[model samples]
Target: MTELDKKINQHFGGKVVRKDLTKLVKGNAIVPTYVLEYLLGQYCATDDEETIYQGVETVKNIISKHFVHRDEAQMIKSTVREKGTHRIIDKIAVKLNDRKDQYEASFANLGLNKIPIGDSVIKEHKKLLSSGVWCILSLAYYPSDEKDASPWIIENIKPIQVSNVDIDEYKDIRKKFSKEEWIDLLMQSIGLNPKEFTLRSKLLQLTRLVPFVENNYNLIELGPKGTGKSHIYSEMSPHGILISGGEVSKAKLFVNNSSGEIGLVGYWDVVAYDEFAGKTKKSDRGLVDIMKNYMANKSFSRGTQVYGASASMVFVGNTDHSVPHMIKHSNLFDALPKDYYDTAFLDRMHAYVPGWEVQKLRNEMFSSDYGFIVDYLAEILKGLRKDDKTNEYAKYFKLSDSITTRDKTSIAKTFAGLLKVIYPHGELNEQEAKELLDFSIENRKRVKQQLQKMDETFEEVDFSYERISDGKRTVIETLEVLEYGVPATKKTLISDESSVKSEGKNVAEDVPFELEGGQKIIRDNQKGISYDMLLGAYLIGATDIKIIDPYVRLPYQLRNFMEFAKLVTEKKEPGVEVKLHLVTNNNEDYVENAKEAFEQMAYSLEALGILFSYEFDENIHDRSIIMNNDWKIILGRGLDIWQKTGAGTILTNMCKNNDCAKHVK
Candidate 1:
């Protein structure tokens, strides 16, 4: 075991299990991760090898015997009939049978229905009444001689979830892990590899948990698909419910006046709408209005009587266009249903998670280490909903006066949720508090900025904060604004030179630049620093350029080199030919392919009055560019210093707003 694994096992003993064990025991079972983890928590929540092996066998046997599969339903039913009684694992939903004057159960996979169940079971596990809950059920088969009598009966049932958790003990033990360790543990619990994400990216993932811990906190995330946007709500928590965007109605989400019955919001702590962003999708305006009212006031009216609910709302969907395309052509909420596109409705959202920044889920991203069982973590987050730490940052920093009351409330709720997730003990210093505060402000600012684009009447506000100690005010900008060029309305009237002087920094044509040791430090995910901005000024008078980078063999790397060549041609005087030389390594597997690609590139560049030549150098490790005009520039990541723009994306052929490469400089 690695040090981190040992440390987590030592600190959170008995409450943690190896995450991969769930996948191992869940061979052909089509159940959620939490259900498998619940079983693991009962038997294999220890680090001992012998105990884990024995537990794995026991769990596998239990699943093979009890779990019902649709294809094998007939065989299992025959076995149950032959045995007279049997226990099976299935998704059992119980409902009241008015005609029979009792509750009946339905097994989703086993294809059985109207099986009589006891009242005690329904009262004990109430979730079965609303949406089906997975359970281990005892079934009895009685052959009936009467013409209309049925034979299936439910003997007993038990929902697969941890009944309760000691919130105080969970909070007390949180102090033992440092902030980094705690974040890693949470990431592992969510089945993500912590090493593959940045601190900022990890925080974005943690923001998904805000809904579970904060009452009535509304969040929306719209971006490309395959980022696991709905995974947490569906798999990680039993207290939350994930519903199809088209499957909800006023009667199902809120109270049904006809029946006088409360809907999902009254029982579930979080009601997440998945696949919620199709422009042409039909929705009831009344439902949108009611949702907006509930999100804002935490109450809704039914027959002139107001009722309150504590459920937070989450919306996750795919965007039809990229961030830049959306900002330029339409608003960020363009993919939302037409009725939900109102500024008033969007203003109620506390945070707009930038899902585009999250990397696509890959096989390597899943964790194999130890983490707290998700059921335990979910219970802890649910218990934390009663605690309020929204004003924790007030002791260290203050918001700008321009921040409105609504803006402050949104920021405070997000900050409090993050604090509950990361620092439940409230043991954060000024730096820590400031980090959370700035993140909170940026999230709210994202919502407000988009609101301004949708409605011009919405005034722009400076999202800045002042430190209590030195009285220094720092302004926060949304990531999109920094990535895309400043919007026309927000552009400053001053010239570039004056703007740099006023800000006391060196500013490039599009992005902010800092000089350290005569080298530029470009941040990851930064936009606007194109090839022209980086090498345009330096290569103005140079005729001969020598580039040395050993990794210029992949298709993307070769494409980067071609882009640099194009830039050199663009900056050269009319009819002037610039000679470019490249020194790179030749991989044994694709040596000939690399040679052909470079030769093809050379032939292509010659048409543009640029002569490109290349040579193989196996011993070259340092990457640098030498210009004949007495200039030598060092490249921290060679020419491939930008992320690959996916096919059919807005930035596919454009270099103005590509994401910065995350390789070390």
Candidate 2:
């Protein structure tokens, strides 16, 4: 292991794992990442070569022996029945069975529904259960039927985490990791590879759930299909639940008025609507109203009684337009259906995840490292529902005096959820507390800022805050306080007057620089030059390179970005890093597409590790592409240089993977 890897193992090994390994240990089981990692920790915590190998075998054997793969599930079941009992690997969560006087368990992804779970499961395995939270329940079941003898017994029930992440220590430990390490730690915590991510980009990846952890956090992400927008609510942790927008009934989601039964919002930490952007999709109007109220008030009224649920709401959908085109034409809200484009409903949202900002999903996106079985993580989140953390961090920090109750609530909820997830032990110091708080504020600010653009009635308020750090308090506002939102922030703090003067001196003047071999370079327009000319020979010459951009929704757009790298690798120097400085927005609609494009590029660039990385391009107005220590190509259009392909454009005329049009203008 590298020094960093060793540190990661020491800090988060038990609670997290490498993301690539998620698939191997994960089989159809939908449990939280932490839960899987918890189990991996017990069985695979060591970095020792032999131990790591043994642990991998043990985990695979455990999954094979117990986890239900539908095809072989019957065989395993038959073995259990033949043995009169069998241990199984599955995500099992429980609820109080009042009438039966026992906690009953539901097996997630194992093809089993609610079964009679014994209290002994909790009593005997409380620590392990809590650590994994989501467990693989081992039940010994004896069938009454003679002919159809199937094993109903589950065994080796444990949480699925590989790290010992104590919530109490999250804040303290958070400070130690640079933002990159922190996210990698989170990925590791959830079993993802940081190598697959950049520091700023990781924040965008995690920003999807910033709302879930924040209370009444209303966010919307609309993009093309397959961005995995619903993954977090549905599979990342058990705290959230996903309901198809088409299937959600008002009663099932909010409180059922007639029966007064609590609904999904009451049970899950976050509630997300899948396929939320289909304007033509059928949906009940009443559900929209109830959702509007809940998003705004954090409570919904059922009949005469008003009850509140702490679940955050996220809307994920596919968009028909690109961000630039959308902005140029109508607005971000234009992607939504007519009914959902309501000013009132949109007002309730806290942030708008630019689903277009996300790249298509890649195979590397799935974790091969151990993580929680999402179902189990869901249960643990449910368990934590009652323990609110809104005020828990107040001792260490305080909000700006100007902040309102609503703002406080938004921050508190997000802060609480994250605190719950990372620092259940509650040992956060000043900086750690502030980082989460700053993030929470930024999410709300994103929503509020766009609301102003759409609705004139909404007043623009500086939603900034103040926090005490190192015996001194610093107040930051606008978007800059929350990394990557730099372009959006109105204020600028410069270290030196001369540097500031120099940076601020030019609006039209071209800056001059020299690439290696004494090649003079100058860029005048806001327009970005093609990567082909910028690093044409150099990138191709390099052995490897990575481009990091947070947004690349359209497949063609992604290809444009990848073509930039291809240009580099095609150059004179044949063995060097060809990293593309990709910076874009975050949105959900393009998850699958982005993943696909990334993978294809990876395959095509296999001979040379040509990579496309991502980072938030909030200040990307002046488009440019840079090569490692070799060159920088400034452009007017960035990666979006292609003209509308309809006027006899080759890309639109013929869309194929290896088309020459893909090589770029």
Q: Estimate every model's Cα lDDT from 0 to 1.
A: 0.81, 0.55
TM-scores for the candidates: 0.77, 0.59
Q: Model 2, stretches more than 4 Å misplaced?
A: 27-38, 72-77, 90-135, 141-165, 169-180, 195-199, 257-259, 363-446, 449-456, 459-665
Q: List the residue pairs that clash in candidate 1.
A: none
Best by lDDT: 1
Global local distance difference test of model 2: 0.55
Residue range 123-153, candidate 2, lDDT tens digits: 7644322112355555676665755334354
* Angstrom error at residue 207, model 1: 0.8
lDDT of 1 by residue, 1-665 (tens): 77888988887787888998988999988988888888888889999999999988888888899889999899889988999999998888776777778888888999998888888887787878766788987888998998757788787788887866888887788888889889989999999888777677788899999999999999999889999999999999888999999999998899889767678898899999999999999999999999989999999986877989999999999999998788778878999989988899999999999989888998888899998899889888999999999899899989999999999999999999999999988799998897788779888998998899899998989788888998977777665665564435333212210011112111254332322123344434555667776666777788998998898887788788888888899888889888999999977887888899988988998998889999999999977777776566667567776545221101111111121222122
**Superposition error at 82 for model 2 (Å):** 2.1
Q: Which RMSD does model 1 reach against the true structure?
A: 7.9
- Model 1 residue runs over 4 Å out of place are 98-101, 143-150, 487-524, 527-665
Q: What would you estimate as the lDDT of candidate 1?
A: 0.81
Which one wins on TM-score?
1
Cα deviation in Å at residue 609, candidate 1?
A: 24
Model 1: per-residue Cα lDDT at residue 364: 87
